[model samples]
Target: MHTDSAAEPRLAGGPATGLVAALDIGGTKIAGALVDDTGRIRVRVQRPTPAREDGETVMRTVEDVLAGLAASPLWPGAGAVGIGSAGPVDAFRGTVSPVNVPGWRGFPLVERVHRATGGRPVTLVGDGVAMTAAEHWLGAARGHDNALCLVVSTGVGGGLVLDGRVHPGPTGNAGHLGHISVDLDGEPCACGGRGCVERLASGPHIARRALENGWRPGPDGDTSAAAVAAAARAGDPVALDSFDRAARALAAGIAATATLVEVDIAVIGGGVAGAGEILFGPLRRHLATYATLSFVRGLTAVPARTGTDAGLLGAAAAARTPRA
Candidate 1:
């Protein structure tokens, strides 16, 4: 499925050497891949997310995965270990809240990854930022100079690429797009705010609103944006309405983002993004409605081409970042 011409991978800053272990730690799963210099993954593995574990336990699970990778062909040969972890991380400090993982409040991630990865040179990055790097280097955002990459699943997260480089701010927190406000009078957010875009546009919020509208099927009735998209595709009125609401909120966010950044495109990814046109069609319509500037009008949102392995590619890119 990968169409890019493959290039020979060399050691970090030298002749292409061994593989880089890419780890993506999420609330639902931990996926790892041994990535080559050409962005090719030779081995892939995933395990259930530790739903009940504390910070130490989560780190243990990560260590176990790395140990397994080290014992297999996927083992790091010469490259480093790279991690794409959930935020909000103090990237400069290599620490994070670990979001859905309860025990990891300000866990030292870089140190953990280094210890678990056999003391290899390790790089830690935001999951959203990693996704954007993967897309820009090899997926839908490939060849584009400026664009936004968004993940719409468990949480709404984003990253930016400007002038051919991932735009992690000086503090490595530039593209935290979900916290932007859409309705100051809206719902409460985990970040302790009201009416943030994530409060209204995230997958859970979509399901919550659907329930309040008496959309039916009870609590078990379609709890994700993907479900809404399916129902919309099948001509379900309530489902359509639910997605329309998401589109409206996301469109507003898009318009505001485009006005500020004026990117060529916005590449949408993750679980919710699978909704395709059901979410994207209305999303485009909504963006059009709010756009007033000529630059904003030209902005289009496209689906990301990279799949689950995006995190690894991104992590590799981060490891290769020249020190400042």
Candidate 2:
């Protein structure tokens, strides 16, 4: 829903000539916006995702979001549509199989959206890739020819910008850093892999590790990673240890990414990153130990500047510059 407090988007320099419609689909919400060529969103609408509903029901929500945008006076000006969706997405085939949205397995989202939008051309990319696009275009990764953009929240997701362009791979699932194994012989992951970074660093896992190591929640029963972060700030040993472990795992994965592809910066965002230095401090220290190659030693990690709008903005970016 549009809010009174939401400011109208202004161009950084001057107006752009054409406009595009952008959709950001995720487990929690679906957002739609009409964006100018300058990457400014002029109108927006959103709704909570009916994640547990059948595929048709979820599609209805998406339609409702689009309907809100179509009602705008700017509709006739939008020449194309871009969608950023949770994955694994097959951009080659215009199909998506997002893990969190079971009803959408192998769903032909691009075709469905094209039909709903009265035949406007559509482009699709993974949510991680979308974030990378946004960062590379206007945020922390801007001007960096090679960069890694990450979202560390309930789950860890990432994408790469190589040779000054977003790299979606053939399937739109490249730079999936969360699934990269940092500890080859350690515990198994939900993705059927062992020692995946998400298993050790996701918010739930961080809180779980703290609890297992003897940290207790407050009377409110708030056992979230935020609570653990607070405890760490207060000098709780168990909480600190949990964050440290997560930082080490992230450092290893980041270092490996740097060594393999040679990114200059790693821009991180999402809920867990709100912990501030509790996460970055150790991550930097550990990166010193793991990213040792002469080529990768200067690789740096920084917080993402793009806020909640990254998805919609990135979708708009993809529409303007369709990946080949």
Candidate 3:
């Protein structure tokens, strides 16, 4: 297990009292933390996810991470446990079926975690929703009554904030923008959709498109989207075109979401967002073309400020906020 003790002060408000045990479960890793109400992480632990292993093995990995957190002296003060997991999670049913972790299908994650955490009330939400909560609480989306927060990485994920509250929907997958089809006759997505935003804008797709269009990697043999961003910065036509296409798809999806939800701002995060202006420049330009409707024409996109700790912070926020 890995541990971090960095203390991040809240942007505003007084220091909060009490703590919540937060867990962020993804295909790559399982992270646990003891977070106070003000969004500070007092203690943290993480473990690599044995994603390819059997369900029990994956559960053990999570349990191990939790055990590490529980070993902390502050763990006894944790009043609740919160989990932000990859979709599709059924918060109503307290189950999770993350697409990348095939070993967990309808797993009773809430119950298992509740038992493991000494029966403290356990709350579960999709990773996308969790990120949204973090943004609304302490990042770029703060003070916005309605917003859409996105994570554009290996796969695209998102969540909504409506009327100044994080809205996870009934099953905790409300603002799932990536799966929305952008092309009626384009490539099929692993989510069984045709030409979804994820198929065109995700990091893997960005790199794949660059490679398919003759954008050779550097001598170091880096073919990631970040590498493509570097090539675009160096004025590579193929790399620039790949990012432009991805940005166009993202713009279309963002525009559609704005039209549907009337979100004033869209906060973009995750590894792919690290491309900076390479992605945002084209996305903003394309968004102008698509979001011409009077109400949505003013919609703006901004970078998420929560960084990598969004998942854990969001889970803590969910644990503290009362849900209806």
Candidate 4:
């Protein structure tokens, strides 16, 4: 999270080998790090995302993050660069069109990063795919051969792993559970879909539903899903109702995914997932009602263990994978 040039990172001991330069680009922030073979970040840098700026301006911010990483002594040992970007990304074309960062529409991110890194090979994947890579590598989905990893934050995003490998599909956007329509006659979603999981289970939607149900923010004036979670923990009916509805939507989506792919586990993360039992308790119960198939009867839902570093670590993990 250090934006100033004066901040110095703790350098790793000895000559670092198998190092990768990792970048996690999102609408909220852009994080960069030099990750070692052990998944430990040696040098780190971060900057606020210039989401509303022109494409070139956002690219400049990305370059700034790279510049900071390059300043670290470990830069020379890095063999390649891995990028996990908020998507709609096309890995084959090396282009990105993130929803929140409208400035980057079909932006040639791979070529730009390649040029910035002095021709070091670059690998790109959607943020959801990146998270899946991370979870499969070292988090809750480590031992599972098939699993779904989801991030329920300001938005809902997800990725899938099959046969012990991340499944990013041809366009690096295979497991986009957020846009999956769960209600045929429900509300329209921003993604031009109706009753999409994101429209129902995302942080914004959860809060909006609570507010619409006459739930008021506390003295802090905070009306985020986290606040609603706190209210639910305190036995507030409206808040609890909002979470239950989101959980139901999430359960339906997860069940549908499991039915299609036969995944054994669902790993949940991000801001709203901080609700913990308030979210998972109802989610598990609802999942039992929807995932009635024999193959999906044993599917378990778990919390992500990678924490906030999942994005950066996942990027590095992608770099180490063949063809990412």
- The number of the candidate with the highest lDDT is 3
What Cα-based lDDT does every candidate model obtain?
0.75, 0.86, 0.88, 0.88
Tell me the spans in candidate 1 whose CA falls farther than 4 Å from its real position.
1-18, 73-76, 218-221
After superposition on all CA atoms, what RMSD does each candidate show versus the true structure? 5.6, 6.1, 5.4, 6.5
* Candidate 4 lDDT over residue span 1-324, tens digit each: 011112221111222348999999999999999998888899999999999999999999999999999998889999888889998888767789998999999999988998999888777888888888888877999888899999999989899988877877777788899999999999999888899999999999999999999999999999999999999999999999999999999999999999999999999999989999999999999999999989999999989999899899888877766431
Cα deviation at 285, candidate 2, in Å, is 0.6
Q: On residues 217-312, what C-alpha lDDT tens digit does candidate 3 reach at each position?
A: 989999999999999999999999999999999899999999998999999999999999999999999999999999999999999999999999
Each candidate's TM vs. the true structure? Answer: 0.90, 0.93, 0.94, 0.94
Q: How big is the positional error of residue 219 in model 2, measured in Å on the Cα after superposition? A: 1.9
Kindly list the per-residue Cα lDDT of model 1 for residues 1-324, writing each as its tens digit: 000112211112221355777888888888887877788888777788785787777877787777667778557373676678887766666677776888888888777776666567666678888898888878998888888888887788888887777876644557777888888888778889878778777888877777678665536665566666666788878878888888788778878877888777889888878888888899888888987688778888899888877777887666655433
Better of 2 and 4 by TM-score: 4
By TM-score, the candidates rank as 3, 4, 2, 1
Worst 10 residues of 4 by lDDT: 1-10
Query: What's the CA error at residue 61 for candidate 2, in Å?
Result: 0.5
TM-score of 4: 0.94
